[model samples]
Target: MAVCLQLTTSNSSMCLCQTFTTHLFLPILYSAMFLTGLAGNVLSLWIFMAKISGKSPTHIYLINLGISNLLLCITMPFIAVYYALGTSWSSRSLMCRLAINVLTPVLHTNIGVGMIILAWLALSRCATLVQHSHGPRPSKCIKILPKVFFSRLRQTPFALGVCMGTWAIVATASIPSVVVYSMKETEVVEDGDKQTCYSVAVEVGGSGSQAFAVIGIVIFFLCLLVVLCAYMAVIRHFYRSRKSTVISDRQRVYARVFRNIVVIQIVLVVCLLPYHIYKAIFINLAQTDSGGNGTECHSLSTYVEIKNVLLCLAALRCSTDPIMYFLLDKTFKKHTLNLIRGRSNTQDSHSSRTECGQSAPYNNSSPKGAATHDTHSHSKD
Candidate 1:
């Protein structure tokens, strides 16, 4: 969260207000998110990097997503501390100002990264399932959609490029916006050190900040639509597979795919949807209700609290993601179990030996062994 000051009639007119939510609730919520998110993401990354055998595109996507999640998790303590003690910290306090400048970008950046990665995961999985399916082609589901668009996402190299591109795009979009909000046009907050963190500027924000917010919300909805469409297409393609007289081995794989999609979709809806939706309303309200005395907070008193709460909900995904990974991917679950049980995964050990230029009795480095590893990984996907 950033410190905000309105550019209305006069900066002094705005009430730098505080409530139970800002003072008491935000710190508690952020602390919980930090503790859980840090643990979950660290564990997930360890499994992704060390334990899982196949470095498939989806796996690689997950790795990048975990990294982004960890980045956000690390910022939580700063945010918690900021809100927890903002009553005593003036708007001009160097530490609070610096933290806001740094972390507001981080919050936006990770949310963008998470959404884009989730979209990529949905599309990649949809492509994999459709390409391998014996049922009807994607033409039967979404006739306008191109198969070539999805094919490239099935490769690990492309996944890496996508993740890198996601970070660049999100950073480019987010950092500039944070600069616009916090650095430029900051005349309002410059008047005095008397303003606390709960000022009206913090609630509704300066008018200039909303321009990029509008663009970000548009992107958010577009990603949400793409995820839902891809999900539906995958369902349609696989629905026919399960209808067979007897379930094939591939159908069982598709069953796993179903669980994966369901989990991701649930995450998007449960965590991010409410925040974005209410954010849109708050933005619109802020834009329209600018006439009231900014001190009275006629437009945004209740809204700021709701938005912050829902934002915590959105951030909650980082904590929940590892649990979802454990349930959806057998490789992750198996490795996690093995690690916890204090046992080695023999297959992982064998693969590790081959990769490290060691001569194993069984040459798992052979072409056939390599194919087996990839095939098994894909099947798990």
Candidate 2:
């Protein structure tokens, strides 16, 4: 009888552990991710608009990436609140389904788009650097790619069509998950207590759904791998061509930007790889019906924990992106500083004017000086 009671207690404990890991711990992890990501992406968006606007194709891509990250972050708080209140989702079924569906595509597309942009940036660097060394002024090549891409990007209808096409691809890739996984209510009975609530779950689709999920995962991984390879090649080529020195500040800035891109790519890989791998394993286990046993339960718990950790790492990307901008884009840093100083000077001038009944002369020597003076006076008003 004592042995029987012990066995029963152990089983209950295991169930509780699994529930807590999935419902409580994972929610908290996602909450942190949401807050961090939202703050970071919003900042990136602002910086892009206010500081980096109309600069380069890379900047345009970065703006899009920021928007995607922001959208994902917005959904995370809902997920966190759902899990925090109880291990159950209290939200409406439709909302749960929409939330889950929206996140997958946003995440998948953001990663893909970001990687593609990085690859383009690297390839552009390689081409421009190679040409500059072989022929006319190196600086001329910097303007050439931007002139070409920007001209193409400027046709409003064409730009819209391109955006639509890219989004269509992402939507197509994500539709399978939306169709196969949806919100459903499940009943949980612990001891004599019973509760029912809605939660996200995979729908009853045979092998087809499983295969589709795998394919989506594979596509993302392939894109990541390709980006990694391209950056590695770029770095190697740069290293080999030591004779082609970065003579000017502009060249130096470009070199630094390339380095930052490499760093960002590395960070993305480190954070995202573990989550995908664990998710792949979890899906495999679920498909095989191997998750019902004790060993599999423990494995699931560990994977959940690992996923939480990865999510935290992924959140770093949002905050880290601003740092990359600061490092890579000297113009952004200068503009930021000018804005700050302009505000400070304006405040000082306002105080002086209030005390002495006279306004300061507007300095219009340099373009930045004129801009700063105007900004300062505007702030005072």
Candidate 3:
């Protein structure tokens, strides 16, 4: 399960002092992520709906990605408010549950789903390129390979179904976190008036928390491996196929898609990998200290601080995705520019017509047929 900073100590009260993390840094970081993620995802969703009709698998995946980020972004401000209130939910247990239990897990779910989709997209492009280079059909002997089995991920309905399944998996996985998360009262210092509010559930040692953290880390690593393999295969294919006499329009589109995959992988490495690594380490340390054998609260505090910083880094993924969409997707870019210039629908229509005329020979729309290297269709949105 995704965790918020453990802001209160269970046994310490004599030297109680305000931590800079829960009071200041977290609030500031969450606020910035909230605003930036909100704007980016909203624009991304608008561009998708206006210019791309979910006709392509990538389009569908990105649309869902945008939605996930948007929802996650909405939760950020509430978290900021929570931290801004000195780590107190002010008796609002439901809000605390909603933020830490529901939204945090959803953020984790988004990362998993996005990474899988991106990796799938990369692998699909590589497979299609290979198919185009070799022959129209795969041999019966190797048709059952995982790559071949998932080749249809590029289809709209198939992608949608996979997305729905991803959400279901995420929801099921988060149930334990929701059930275990609850508010606990912290002791007041000498001359204290009221008890401080903090959640005490599963700060370190809970079967559910440990299980979820381990599972999340495992999922992240698996997805990372998939992404790395897809990238390597695509790069290898490009290297070997460079000497081909004729390059189809489909291959050119594949090249562009591969570049997008590369960028997304880079972003994932920067924004996500460190956090998961730290998460695993943090969980392990907590498990080790669960026995209460000379545990160091200062060390735990430092780890919690580092973990929160890493969480913020992971949150940057939501903000960066719309940037990825604008940078990598030509259709999205064109539509964004048009929107900025206050262009009329009629002008946009004209621009789309012009784009259709000069595009690559193969129609990139209809991802299922793209593998055959058909040149009749327009570029994918």
Among these predicted structures, which one has the highest TM-score? 1
Tell me the tens digit of each residue's lDDT in model 2 across 1-381.
Answer: 000001122234322122565456667777777766776677667755654323333455556666756766776676565445422332234444454456544555565555444444444444433332322223333454565653444233443455455656776766665565432212223353222122112211235555765775687587677666555654554444434544443344335545565666667777667666765775666566533445323224454445545655554465556556555544445444555567565554444344223212323344333333222221110
lDDT agreement with native, every candidate: 0.71, 0.48, 0.62
The TM-score of candidate 3 is 0.79
RMSD of 1: 5.3
Residues 227-270, model 1: lDDT tens digits:
99888987877787567525355566656667767777788899
Cα error of candidate 3 at position 269, Å: 0.5
Models 1 onward score TM values of: 0.85, 0.64, 0.79
The candidate, 1 or 2, that scores higher on lDDT is 1
118, model 2: CA deviation in Å?
4.1
Candidate 3 displacement at residue 354 in angstroms: 5.1
Kindly give the number of clashing pairs for every candidate. 2, 0, 2
**Which clashing pairs does model 3 show?**
362-375, 363-377
